[model samples]
Target: MMAADETSARLTAVLDKVRALGPTLRERALEAERAGRHSDETIADIDATGAFEIGSPAEFGGYEFSVRQQLDVVTEVAKWDGSCGWTVWAGASTNWIPAGSGARVVEEVYKPEWVGPRVAGSSHFPASRGRAKRVEGGWQLSGGPWTFGSDALWAPFTNLGCIADDGEGPYLVGAQVPLGELRFLDDWHVAGMRATGSVSCKLAADELFVPDHRCVDFRDITGGNLDNGLKGSLWQAPSLGWSFSLMAGMSIGIAQGALERFLERSAGRPIRGTTYKNQLEAPLTHLMLAEFHSKVQSATLMTRANAEETDRLGVLAAAGTPADPDYMQRFSARVLVETAYAAKWCAEAVELLQRNSGSTAIMDFEPIQRAWRDARVVTLHGALNLEALSENYGRLMAGVQPHNFAGITTLDRFAPTAPNKAV
Candidate 1:
């Protein structure tokens, strides 16, 4: 078991490192967005932090910290720069899969470099077709076009969901394939988050081999077959909870960064014909700051509470006394929705500050402008799609069958098209 001091020290060290690199990373993100691609150095820094290692098992040299800590790291990084935080956090979150094909495949990817794994996934399953047919030694996979495969540039492995036409029913599967065998399409052109390097990719092999061990039936993960002991206690207690709570931290961090810039720019800057010496004394400015602070604090608390609950459940699950699957599902749904809502709130704060910051906020080279755009873009990620997630949570609360067990339908929608051509 890791001592309290050990965990605290580790978290602090990572946060410090992230903060130290924030300015450089922020600049790189802006450049990538403008240039339509990320630099190799930016990718290397992400790998070096071992931020991707947060989700792997300790046996594999990962910190294997609770979900809350992972969230915190992501949130904090996002504050410095949204795209980097998004890439890093998303990469780490992919490690949350149960120990089976998903975990094994990821482990295989990380085994060689230990520099963190690369991840690019989209919940929009219907948009692509990739499939694995049962075969000798390994399964054969073929498909084309998956979206949001961030971190694909350096990642040696990638995962795609497929469906098998089992005589009984359509069975869903997630296939892990070596990055070397896949083809990337240049399609990720957008106004924001261009640095994520998200593009369409095709995986075609005359029978790409996926060893049996690396193949995991999606049913197993959704069925809740994973059972571990240590995770429960660490995640259960409220005081010790808030590990996954870091996601909100990222939003807060972004808001904080913007707020700082606004303050610096607005202070002593007079509006024409105004009696006030500077914008700082403006009544509207005071109200904006107050609202921003209040919203940030509220979001932080909600994030903390959800993180605590997630931890508590982990402890229970680890103790061999897993919580009711339905309850767990509900909890997860709520947290996911709330986190997105918090992000929205944070984004609003940024917008407010930007609106009041005058023309300075729109300067392409200004970090405040970049932060605003990045937060706005990231809020649109399918994972953060608030309405769908809220409805999912409502179903759980009302004892209605969930649309998808994984809490995100983006992946499940692709099941039907997995066998034939890529969608």
Candidate 2:
């Protein structure tokens, strides 16, 4: 392991590279949204920052930075542009998946000479998922046009999910397939996050062969059990924990960026029908800004705390002292609930600022409006919805059974016994 001081220095250097792109990311925010994807120039600019390597294995030439450091980088990128930050989240978070598939698959996926991100991934939404059947040496994958294939266009490979039957019943499996074997659709139209290019995709044929080594049980990925023989704290962390934790940073960045732009645009502007010549001079404006500022700060604190705990658990796991089942369930629950809350708070903050920005703020060219839309979309994500997550957390706190699967509401082995004893 590197010394603490060296790690900090390396993190700072990576941050500096991404920080310098803030202006460029902000400048292109509108263009990317209009194009329904990032421009080639913008994509190359971000790739050059080395930010996407934060979650990859260091053995494969990736930085594999700690959870906290990775969150910091994502938050900073988001402060410039939501789409750019989101793209980083997709690329960086999925890089860890190949690690769990073991060495043979990892070797093929994480080539040292790869110039940009190594992978993109499909969303967990079941409606757009595909199907697979176990076959000799691999699975025959079919029935896709997987929706929400984020960052797939530029990635070398995409880890796609499919429903597979193992005799008794059906289960989800993830297969890492080369980008060339799939087709992307231009169907990402939406009210927010329009530039993420999270479009639908399908196999080039009715059946594409995915070698068994490249496919893994979805459970192992979330449990942090897919080992590629790396000895880093990051590889030991739960995949969902790292993914949602870093995603919370995007919410923070978008909220922070919206506030910055609001202040800049409101400087000398009047409250049209009010007596104040400048909105900043109004007491109401002061109160509104303070409220959102508090929300953003609170959300950031929650996100950072969860990230630290994730790293601590990873360290323990690496040392052969994995967290107890009950504790692991609680940790997983906290990460999920906290992530949802952060999304809620950040989205609310942006919405409040957008509302107070007056009529002109709704113009197509206004970045604050874009931030507002993007923030809303983040909250609306199925996995990150505040109401659904809050209900699950409340159930856990009340000792009621969770309504969803383990790793989402609780870890499988650690699910509380006597769930109905509380109610």
| TM, every model | 0.85, 0.94
Off by over 4 Å in 2: 123-128, 406-423
Clashing pairs in 2: 100-226, 145-201
Can you write out model 1's per-residue Cα lDDT over 300-415, one digit (the tens) per residue?
A: 88987787676766676557676654455455566777878888998898888888777766878787887787767757866677887778767656656447543233223222
Clashes of 2: 2
lDDT of 2 by residue, 1-423 (tens): 567887788889889999899988898888889899988788788878888777777777777789999999999999888988889988887766777767877888776566556778784444436888899998999987788888888888888888888898877777888989989898999998888888888899889999888888776765556567788888887666787888899999999999999999899889977898899899999999999989999999999998888888888888888776556666777788889889888999999899999999999788899899888888887677667677766776876645655222334535554433311
- What's the C-alpha lDDT at position 235 in model 2? 83
Q: Which candidate is the best by TM-score?
A: 2
Clash count of each predicted structure = 26, 2
User: Please, what is the whole-model Cα lDDT of each candidate in the order they appear?
Assistant: 0.65, 0.81
Worst 10 residues of 1 by lDDT: 414-423
